[model samples]
Target: MKLIGSSTSPYVRKVRIVMAEKKLDYRFDEESPWTQDSKVSESNPLGKVPCLVMEGGEAVFDSRVIVEYLDTLSPVGKLIPSTGRERVEVKTWESLADGVIDAGVLARLEATWPDRKESERSQAWIDRQTGKIRLGLAAMSRGLGDKPYCSGIHMSLSDIAVGCALAWLAFRFPEIDWRTDYPNLARLHDKLMQRASFAETQPR
Candidate 1:
C-alpha cells in the first residue's frame, strides 16, 4: 500500500495519523496536487491528495474514506464508533473540523494571489470564514468541556479531525492565537500531541 499526499495538508495529516494509530505499514508518496509535477492525477481522477493505493492497484481518495478504510484494518484503537448515535456524533464533529480547515485553506490561497486586486480580496469574505472558524471552535470547546476526547473517553475520528484542524491553523495562521481564546482546545491539543500518531504525523 502507498499514501499519496503532501506533508502540509491537514487532510493528508489526518490519514497519516489514522495509519499510525492502526500500525499499518505502507509507503508514503509526498507530492502536492497543486504542484506542476504532481502524479496524483494518475491515481485519483479528482486529483486530490491523500490518495491511498492498495496493493491490488485500487486507489481510495478523500480523507474520510481513507480513514474509515484504515479503521477496518485494526480491532484495537478504533478511531470511529461501531454503531449508534456515537457514530453520527463523531461524524458531525469531523464535518465541523473539516469545515474550519476548508475556510482556513481558502483564505490561505486567496492571500497568495499576487495579481488579485484589493477589491477582489474581499475582506468581508475572509472575515465571514474566520467567524465560522471561531464559532466552530467555541462549539467544540463546549461539547468537549472536561472530556479527554471529542466524542467520549477514548480518542475517535473527531479527535483526529479536530487535531488536524488545529495543526493546520497553527501552521498557516500563527498570529490567530486560537489557543489563547480556546483553552480547552489547547489542552486537548496538548494531550493529543503526546500520542505517537499526532507527534509523528505533525505538519511540516
Candidate 2:
C-alpha cells in the first residue's frame, strides 16, 4: 500500500500518525495536489492529498476514510469504536477537528490568490471560521478537562484528529494563541505528542 500526500498537510499527517500508531507498513509517495506534477488527480477524482492506494490498484481518498480503513487493519489499538453511541461521539469529534482544518485551508487558499485584494476578501468569512475554531477549542477543552484523551481514557481517532488540527493551527497561525486560551487542549496535545506515532508524524 502507498499513501500519497505532502508533508505539510494536516490531513495527511493525521493519516500518517494513524499508520504509525497501528504499525502499518506502507510507502509514502510525497505529492501535493497543488503541484502540476502531482499524480493525485489520477488517484482521486477530487484531486486531493492523503489518497491511499491499495496493492490491487484501488484508491481510497479522504483522510477520514483512510484512517478508518487503517484502524480496521489492527484489532489491538482500534482508533475508532466499532458500534453504538461511542462511535458517533468519536465521529463527531473528528468532524469538528476536520472543520478546523477546512476553515484554515480555505482561508489560506483565498489569501494565496495574487489578485486577491485584502479589502475585497470577505473578512466576515474569515472571522466566522475563526469563531468556529475558537468555539471548537472551548468545547474540546471543557469536554477533555483532565482526561488524557478525547473520547475516553484511552487514545482514539478523536484525539488524533483534534491534535493534528490543533498542531496545524499552531504551525500556520501562531497568532491565534490557542494554548493561552485553552489549557486543557494544550495539555491534551502535550500528552498526545508523547506517543511515538505523533512524534514521528508531525507536519513539516
Candidate 3:
C-alpha cells in the first residue's frame, strides 16, 4: 500500500497517525497536489492529498475513508467504535475536528498568494476561517475539559483528527497562540505527541 500526501497537510497526518497506531506498514509517497505534475488526479478525481492506494490498484481518498478502512485491517488499536450510539458520537467528534482542518486549509490556501493586492486579498474571509478555528478550539476544549482523550475513554479517530488539526493550525498560524489560550487542547496535543506516531507525523 502507498499513502500519498504532503508533509504540511493535517488530513494526511491524521491518516498517518491511524496507520501507525494500527501497526499497518505501507509506503509513503509525499507529493503536493498543488504541483502541476502531481499524480493526485490520477487516483482521486477530486485531486486531494492523503490518497491510500492498495496493492491491487484500489485507491481510497479522503482521510476519513482511509482511516476507517485501516481500522478494519487490525484490531491492535481500533480508532472507531464498532456499533451503537458510541460510534455515532465518535463520528460526530471526527466531523467537528475535520471542520477545523477545512477552515484552516481554506485560509492558508488563500494566504498562499502573498503578492496579491490588498483588494484582491480578503482579510474578512481569512478572519471567518480563523474565527471557525477559534470556535472549534473552544468547543473541543470545553467538551474535553479533564479528559485525556477526546472520546473520554480511549484514543479514537476524534483524537487523531483534533490533534492533527490543532498542530496544523499552530504551524500555519503561530500568532494565534493556541497552546496558551486553550490549556486543555495544549495538554491533549502534548499527550498525543508522546506516541511515536504523532511525533513522527508532525508537520514541518
Candidate 4:
C-alpha cells in the first residue's frame, strides 16, 4: 500500500497515526494536492490528500474510510468498535473532531487564498467557520470531561481524530488558544502526544 498525502494535512496525519498504531507497513508518498503538478487527482477525483492505493491498484480516498479499512486489516490495536452503540459513540466523536477540522480548513483557505483580492475575501465567511470551531471545541470538551480517552478508558479513533484536530489548530491558527480554554482537552492532547504514533506524525 502507498499512502499519498502531505505531512501538513491533519486528515493525512490521522490516517498515518492509525496505521502506525495498527503496526501496518506502507510506503509514504508525500504529495500536496494544492500544487500544480500534484498527482492527487489521479487517485482521488476530489483531489484530496491521504489517498491510499492498495497493492492491487485499488484506490481508497477519504481519511475516515482509509482508517476504518486499515483497522479491519489487522487486530493489533482496534481503534473503532466492531458493533453496537459503542461504535456509534466513537464515530460521533470522530465526526465532531472532523467538523472542527473542516471549519478550520475553510477558514484558513478564506484567509490565505493567493489569487483572491482583499476586497474579494469575506471576513464574515471566515468568522462563521471560526464560530463552528469554537462551538465544536466546547462540545468536545464537555463530552470528554475527565476521561483519559475521548470515548472511555481505551484509546479509540475518537482520541486520534481529536488530537489531530487540536494539533492542526495549533499549527495553523496559533492565535486560537484552545489549550488554555479547555484544560481537559489540553491534558488529553498532552497525553496523546507522548505516544510514538502521535509524536512522530506531528503535522509539519
Candidate 5:
C-alpha cells in the first residue's frame, strides 16, 4: 500500500499514526493537493490528501474510511470497536475531532489564500470558523472529563483523531490557546504525544 499525502495535513497524520499503532507497513508518497502538479485528484475526486492505494490498484480516500479499513487488516491494536454502542461512541468522537479540524483548515485558508484580494477576505467567516473550533474543543473537554482515553479505557480511534486535531491547531493556529482553555484536553494531548506513533508523525 502507498499513502499519498503531505505531512502537514492532520487527516494524513491521523492515518499514519493508526498504521504505526497497528504495526502495518506501507510506502509514504508525500503529495500536497494544493500544488499545481499534484496527482491527488487522480486518486481522490475530491482532491484530498491521505489517499491510500492498495496492492491491486484500488484507491481508498478519506482518513476515516482508510483508518477503519486498516484496523480490520490486523489485530495488533484495535482502535475501533467491532460492534455495539461503543463503536458509535468512538466514531462520534472521531467526527467531532474532524469537524474541529475542518473548521481550522477553513479558517486558515480564509486568512491566507494568496490569490484573494485583501478587500474580499471576510473576517466574519474566519471568526465563525474559529468560533466553531472553540465550541468543539469545549464539547470535547466536557465529553472527555478525566478519562485517559476518549472512548474507552484504552486508546481508540477517538484518541488518535483528537490528538491529530489538537496538534494541527497548535501547528496552524498558535493564537488559539486550546491548551490553556481546556486542561483536560491538554492532558490527553500530552499523553498521546508521549507515544512513539504520535511523536513520529508530528507535523512539520
Candidate 6:
C-alpha cells in the first residue's frame, strides 16, 4: 500500500495519524496536486490528495474515506464508533474539524494573491473564513468541555481531525493566536501531541 499527500496538509495528517495508530506501514509518496506532473490525478480523479493506493491497484481517498478504511484494518485503536448515536457524534466532530480546516485553507489561498494590493486583498473574504475558524474552535472547546478527548473518554477520529486542523493553523497562520483564545483547545492540542502518531507527523 501507498499513502500520497503533501507533508503540511491537515487532511493528509488525519489519514497518516490513523495509519500510525493502527500500526500499518506503507510507502509514502509525497505529491502535492498543485504541482505540475504530480501523480495525484492518477490515483484520485478529483486531483486532491490523502489518496491511499492498495496493493490491488485501487485508490481510496479524500481524508475521511481513507481514515474510515484504515480504522477497520485493526481493532487496536478504533478511532470511530462502529454503531449507534456515538458514531454520529464522532462523525459530527469530524465534520466540524474538517470544515474549520477547509475555511482556513480557503483563507490561506485568498490571502496569497501577491499581485493584489493590500487594499484590494478582499479583507471581507479573509475575515469570513477566519471567523468560521474561530467559531469552529469555540464549538470544539465546548464539545470537549471537561472531557479528556474530543468525544468522551477515548481518542477517536474526532480528536485526530481537530488536532490536525489546529496544528496546521499554528503552522500556516501563527498570527491568528487561536491557542490563547481557547484554553481548552490548547490543552487538548497539547495532550494529543504527546501521542506518537501526532508527534511523528507534525507538519513540516
- lDDT for residue 192 in candidate 5, whole number 0-100: 96
User: Per-residue error at 95 for model 3, in Å?
Assistant: 1.1
Kindly list the per-residue Cα lDDT of model 4 for residues 90-190, writing each as its tens digit. Answer: 99999999999999999999999898898899999999999999999999999999888999999999999999999999999999999999999999999
Q: For candidate 4, what is the total of clashing residue pairs?
A: 0
**Candidate with more favorable, higher TM-score: 4 or 6:** 4
Pairing residues by index, what is the TM-score of model 3? Answer: 0.95
Off by over 4 Å in 4: none
Candidate 1, 50-109: lDDT as tens digits: 899999999999999999889999886888887889999999999999999988877776
The C-alpha stretches of model 3 lying farther than 4 A from their native spots are 114-118
**In candidate 2, which residue ranges exceed 4 Å CA deviation?**
115-120
lDDT of 6 by residue, 57-172 (tens): 99998888888888898888888999999999999999999999999988988898566777777889999999999899889988889899888888889999999989999999
Which candidate achieves the best lDDT against the true structure?
Answer: 4
Question: Per-residue lDDT of 76-154 in model 2, one digit per residue for the tens?
Answer: 6888989999999999999989998898887776666557887778777777777777787778788787877889889
Candidate 1 runs further than 4 Å off: 114-119
Instruction: Compute each candidate's TM-score over C-alphas.
Output: 0.95, 0.94, 0.95, 0.99, 0.98, 0.94
Candidate 3 minimal-lDDT segment of 10 residues: 109-118
Which digits, one per residue and each the tens of the lDDT, describe model 5 over residues 104-182?
9999899898989899999999999999999999999999998888886899999999999999999999998999999
- Weakest 10 consecutive residues, lDDT, candidate 1? 106-115
